[model samples]
Target chain A: MVAGRAGGEVMVRSPGRFTEISQDECLELMATTTVGWLAFVDAEGQQLLPVNFVLHGQDVYFRTMSGSAISSLADGHDDVAFAVDHHDDIYQKGWDVMARGTTARVDDPDLVAQVAAGARPRPWAPGERDVLIVLRPSVISGRRVRRQ
Target chain B: MVAGRAGGEVMVRSPGRFTEISQDECLELMATTTVGWLAFVDAEGQQLLPVNFVLHGQDVYFRTMSGSAISSLADGHDDVAFAVDHHDDIYQKGWDVMARGTTARVDDPDLVAQVAAGARPRPWAPGERDVLIVLRPSVISGRRVRRQ
Candidate 1:
């Protein structure tokens, strides 16, 4: 296995056809996309929901409506995972990037102002998604696969 | 909330812009795709991994290496979630379908033979993915978003 490190994230490669992507590269891939899946454990068990996100620096941000399931992620439950990837089914090649860490509802006025000024994430679904949630990942990892 | 039922699956809709997709429609949508993300809790916490899957009857099946992280799902841990969706970034419209259930390795000779004879899932990553895992969802639900 080959491993690379960047900050708190690590690149992992097993003895297979897939190659591990460096943390820097993982973040780059994440920045190139706006859609990802958020995995969290709720009363019904593990759930994966699709969301539109924006990457700002090392943090990920998304908008949700108040009183919604995703908006409740800010209630101090930190065990969450966000992942983004692109795949060419016809070519059978793709890459996957995953960020794991705690989630917090962005309530700080200063930070909210900065988010509004910066690259803010927009929800694809209509309605009032006034609540902004941020995911600060403690670990980021990714894998790339090429046609063999 | 508007709810619809089909067998063990249900369609859920909250007071939001998105509408709930019927269980039958969800399954039909699933059959049109071959890739999805699988969410499960391991020693490290919640994880989502992309997989190439095939829907056979009412079950979902995927292939993985024997010692890979996914292959370990057969060890009696039933808390797992699988999701598949498609979105048009330009149109800002899409649909999402999720399946929650227990996972088990298919070891029955008859079942294995049937799988070999029926539709078999092919792994996109190059490797000897001999282990086959099946997820029989207890709850299958979905949501659809349209340009408004």
Candidate 2:
């Protein structure tokens, strides 16, 4: 096992190296992290695009342009994968949390009104992102490599 | 446009919010960044898993454990999406680079010998990463959000 400085994180390693994070930790990280990648299928192949998301309970919500690639592909599809990971490459440590779920457009006026009244994920990209999609995660998995 | 601090990186924003990066810059960033998420399709649907990768010209290469999901998926497939993006959530700024390509096991003994002598992406995960997979990118696209 090696020890070193990575960014501001003090990293220590154990012989085993990687640990599986708990469900609670996975949900906590998902709520706190602002950026993640959303993977969906496209004509050419599997497409993964970065998105800014907000956690509402156990569901993930994000906005995209109505005609954007994500919006188009996500239409009428339920299966989606969202992944968030952080790395300290200098110290050879990191963690990845992945969630798989079904997605649907937030079209119900009542539900839209409810979300509008609460915290929302503001789009970082410029433009009017009117299409709101919500992902209800069915399974969550995580693995971490940290100094033990 | 808003400006702020995030993980010691200076952030700026533009009115339109997103900027396109050049091919050379994309390749350079790909080479320097050690961690990225690889997206592929499986029975469950689209999957995005993080992997440590090294850039070899236009191709991206990584090693995974023999029984790992990545190794199993890349066994006989070509279409895969590898994405690397960075963000300063404090300032609501970031960029994403995506590459679409095919993956194949690097079984050529002579080529493996050549790569062994050069800079390789050391896996951060614990395990004997004997299965070497290489992704030959066919399409590359990038977008960044920066202050004007």
Candidate 3:
């Protein structure tokens, strides 16, 4: 069991058959994946959506329609989380990587041009997704589930 | 474009090549999947974790080891969100279901016994996960991404 305190709140983690992966491994995993889930809070409440993402350095980037739910992430409501995981149901093995951070709109012409020119994320859902949002993670962590 | 007010905040959704699925369809899709991601806020910040869940009526239930990150959901930090999605990279088609709600611990012996005896969710990770947490969603929504 692991016990700690976060912002005066007690946090405990019970024993489980899983091991934490290093930050390097987490970044590698994030780089290899093209899709991930983005979680954020809106006026209604919390929302989670799957988005195609690309890793540029340590920041995660994805494109969205100008007024879509995800595009709202760049409107000053920056607290957000992103997660990527691969699970094999038959073998019951998988790994998960999660990053928590703030988001901002990628509006710099030079930076946007560079991102659009090199290894840019392609949205699966069609239509013009011209707005780019970048999530600069403050913390990144991961865990790998062990075989039973 | 779709524009509306959410809690006095302007919410906009630009044109996208995706269609919203009905509530019934969302419920059905959720019932078919055993694994979903749960998003919540803790002292550290926003967190997202994959969990194996079972649908009970309109509620979702999952087990966690005591003191685990998920078990903390029942500790009065009830504002949470759950999401399940299936994506086909080759086909470029998929669907997503999201539920936003509150969580409560299942302590009733009879209900616990019944859940354990029924279509209870079996965690892929090895552990004695005895604590059951139920998410009662106040809103559920979904969308289907069309093939490009």
Residue range B1-148, candidate 3, lDDT tens digits: 2333333222224333688999999999998778899998787667788987878778888878788888888775557999998877677678989998889887766666555555433565666666678899989999998555
Candidate 2 residue lDDT tens string, B8-83: 2212232547888888888877776778899888665677888877787788877676777898755767778998
lDDT tens digits, residues A43-99, model 2? Answer: 645878888777777777776666788776347566789989877656667788999
| Tens-digit lDDT string for candidate 3 (A20-85) | 999999999888767799988787567788988878888987877787889888775557999998
- Candidate 1 reaches a DockQ of 0.21
Top candidate, metric DockQ = 3
- TM-score per model for chain B alone? 0.83, 0.80, 0.84
Judging by TM-score, tell me the better candidate of 1 and 3.
1
TM-score of each: 0.84, 0.83, 0.83
| Candidate 1 C-alpha RMSD relative to the actual structure | 9.9
**TM score of chain A per candidate:** 0.83, 0.78, 0.83
Error of 2 at B109 (Å): 2.4
Q: Clashing residue pairs in candidate 2, if any?
A: A12-A147, B12-B147, B13-B146, B13-B147, B14-B146, B14-B147, B78-B102
Q: What TM value does chain B of candidate 1 have?
A: 0.83
Model 1 chain A: ten consecutive residues of lowest lDDT: A7-16
